[model samples]
Every structure is written in structure tokens, then in C-alpha cells.
Target: MSGIIQLDNSDCSYIKANVSNSHNDAVAFEMKFAKDITIAQLKSKLEILTGGSASTMKVELYKGDTFVTALSNNDAKLGFYVNCDGLRLHVIDTFASFGFDSESVEKFELTNDQYEQRGDSVRNFLKQNRLGKYNDEEMQQMEAKRREHAEQMQKRAESCVLGARCQVTVAGNPTRRGTIMYNGPLEGKTGIFIGVQYDEPLGKNNGSVGGKSYFVCPPNYGGFVSPLSVEVGDFPPENFDLDDEL
Candidate 1:
């Protein structure tokens, strides 16, 4: 007796297809689909992988870069389009050309303080793993460096005397002439901050910050800066008239 069985063409159940899309043409993926599956069903499955909506997607059949027929009828079976192994199933997302994708959707984000409070955050993971700043040796080194910087800044602040004429020379800013109004530590902040009363109205505050008054000065003519950027000099105030400018 012969032990071999014969199968007909009707036994073929699935077709392997190379899938791609218009938005991303650099890569193609091979996927298998049942021959009896309808076009709408196939589109619903493709939507998860392509990030395109099934309702607005247009599927086209291809044979190794050669153009074939489009699977336009959603109710028709995939096998009706003469689907075979190694054929390409290209998807065209109608709204993709108009910048529609997952990136276009608004996303929720957490602030620094909010993220720090979450136990499942990446910062908490690093802290538990004892990596980066959580390491004992690194923490000690960071503290030493911070103290060294504080001492250097304190030494620089000793040169900035109150009521002395000085010039502020911060990087990427025009040289400004001012008088040293206050020279000490600011409230609720580290390091020495130099309070200056600028000759012109080109400052961010009126000799106050966080509702605390450090000195007396007109509005928009007081600024607080680092002592390193201040130079005690014989700088005189320059006079200007608004009508002289073009």
C-alpha cells in the first residue's frame, strides 16, 4: 500500500507578502495572511504595524517592485487579487502626507519634581541600582567640588564692596556700568550674589527678588549677578538723550 497523499491547489491557505508603506519606503517586512481573509480584515491587522488608520489606507499589490492591481474592494477576499508568496503589499496612508502620525498626537509629560516623586521612574531605578549620582564615591566627589566652588566665589565677592563703582562684564552681554549695592548671599540660594544698580534701565528687577528687597533702586535698573563677572573700577555713568537716536 502507498503511504503518500496528494493535495490540490485549494489546500493553500496562507500567502506570504512583503509589506511596506509610502511614509517609510526604506524597509520592507514580510508577513503572512490567510487567503480567505477580507481586505478590511487585512487592513485592520496592518493598522497596528503601520500606524495608519484602516479606514483611510489604500493597499496595493506588487510583484518585486513591479506594479500590480490595488486591493480596492474591502469586502472581497485577499485571494481574489491573485495573492501569492513573495508578493508586496504596499500601504498608502491618505493622511500621512498631511503630517498625520503618532508624533502629531499630543503627549502627556511630567515635570522634574513630579517625575522624582514617582517610584517607577528611571531616576528611582538608577538610585536603586546605585549608579551615577547615587553612588557613594561620586556623591562625595560632587560635594567636595561644590564646596571648592563656593569658597572660590566667596573669595571673589570680598573684592566687591557696597556703594563702590563697578562694571558688569557677563559673557554674551554688553558691558554695563553700575554701583555695587549689595554683596552677600541671597535668600534661600547658595553662592554669593552681587546686587548692582545699573546706570540705565536694562535690568530684570527693581533691587528685589522673590518679594524680598535687597536694596533700593528704580524699576528695571537693578540686577543681581555672580561676583566673578563684576570688576571694581572707576567706571562713570554715560548720559544719553532719547531724541538723539534714529
Candidate 2:
């Protein structure tokens, strides 16, 4: 019975599925599948809802401790075992039961509101299971990293003297060569800044960032960068020549 079934209708059959993970955490949800879908296709859909691999998931039709035949073949059609509508399919995830990999299974491309709703469910589950220790440890580590970054920024700000030759390396952007025109906080800004007058016109504004000017320069020839990203160095401009002095 591990082949396609010729059903009378082409419409998808919506059925309630009881998906249980390795830890016995169960979630009931409605799933739609074409009547002639193979066992492999049904297993794939259950994997999305339960994190169960198609190779390891066990499918069964049961009712109140009643023993029923398990769906063992991945090539069989749904209509082979699912005789009528509203049939309950219990999907057991063997991969999760052994506690080997416990990564969260979530859908991607979710909106902010959808993420917030899912986050609430996760928070409730964590609270009920007392699984907040791992999250707390991760937060502490992140806070430590923030403090380390602040200390580095303070050192860079103190070392950045006006007219100092510097190179700014913004993440994912090309390195920029410039001179430190100013080295202090701008008006209406929270953190210290390094106003760089670039050797080329690869800047956003004339020594300004976000509409606040810290120093004057030609338009599109200067920009403000974070002191943390500014590398104060003895390296002069690439075109600077000792032969000119000679």
C-alpha cells in the first residue's frame, strides 16, 4: 500500500494533526495535504510543524490508547491509510526524543508582530519548564561584551588627537583614509565621535553625521565615524612623498 491513491477529488484535505516532540511536548494543529500525496510528502509537512526528520518520524492513527497500524512506508499515499476526513495523525519525532539537538524550530520571514507573538509562547514555555538559565547566561555574556566595547571606545577617543592620520573601517564597508578633524561628541548626540576629512570624496557630508556638523569641509568630503572604528596611525597619505622635501 506504499503507492499513490486515485482519489475522487483534487482538493486538499484539511486534517487535525497531533505532533509530539522527543520531550513529549505536543502541539495540535490543522494541516492540509493533497489526497494523493505520498508518505514522504506528508512527513515533510509534519517536519515543519514538529522538527521531526522524514526518515525518523513515526506516523500512526490512534484513539484513546487504542493500538493502530503505523504508517511505515514513505512511498504510500495518504488515502491508503487516511480512510475518512478528520482522521487524527500522531507524528512522533524520534530525533528530538533523544535530546541530541535541541535547537528551536521556527518559521522564517515572520513580521515583527508575528515574532512578538511567538516570543510570548516561548517565554511561557521557558517559565513553565524553568529553562531560563541558558538564556540568562547568554545575556550576561552579551553585557560583558558591551562593557568591553565601551572601554575600547574610550581609549580610542582619548588617543585620537586633531590632525591625527587615521583609517576608518566600518563593518561590511571599504576602509577609508582620512584625517581626524575633530574628536569629541557632537551636539544632540550621546557618544564621542571622530570627524574625519577623507583624502577622497567618499564621505556622506562635510564633517557632519546625521545633520550635525562637528567640523567644516567641502560637501561629500568628510564624515563622522565611531572612535572604535577609527585607527589612529603613523601611516601618512599614500601620495605623500619624501622626494618633494628632497
Which structure among the candidates has the greatest TM-score? 2
Clashing pairs in 1: none
lDDT of 1 by residue, 69-119 (tens): 688999988876743355578999953445557677886777778977989
Q: Write the per-residue lDDT of candidate 2 for residues 97-211, one digit (tens) a residue.
A: 4553445645346555674477456534654454422246644653465467568778978999999999888644688898999988666444677888988888888876657
Q: Which stretches of candidate 2 lie over 4 Å from their true place?
A: 1-122, 128-134, 187-190, 240-246
- How large an RMSD does model 1 have? 27.3
Where is model 1 more than 4 Å wrong at Cα?
1-130, 134-141, 238-246
Cand. 2 TM to true fold: 0.44
lDDT of 2: 0.64
**How high a TM-score does candidate 1 get?**
0.42
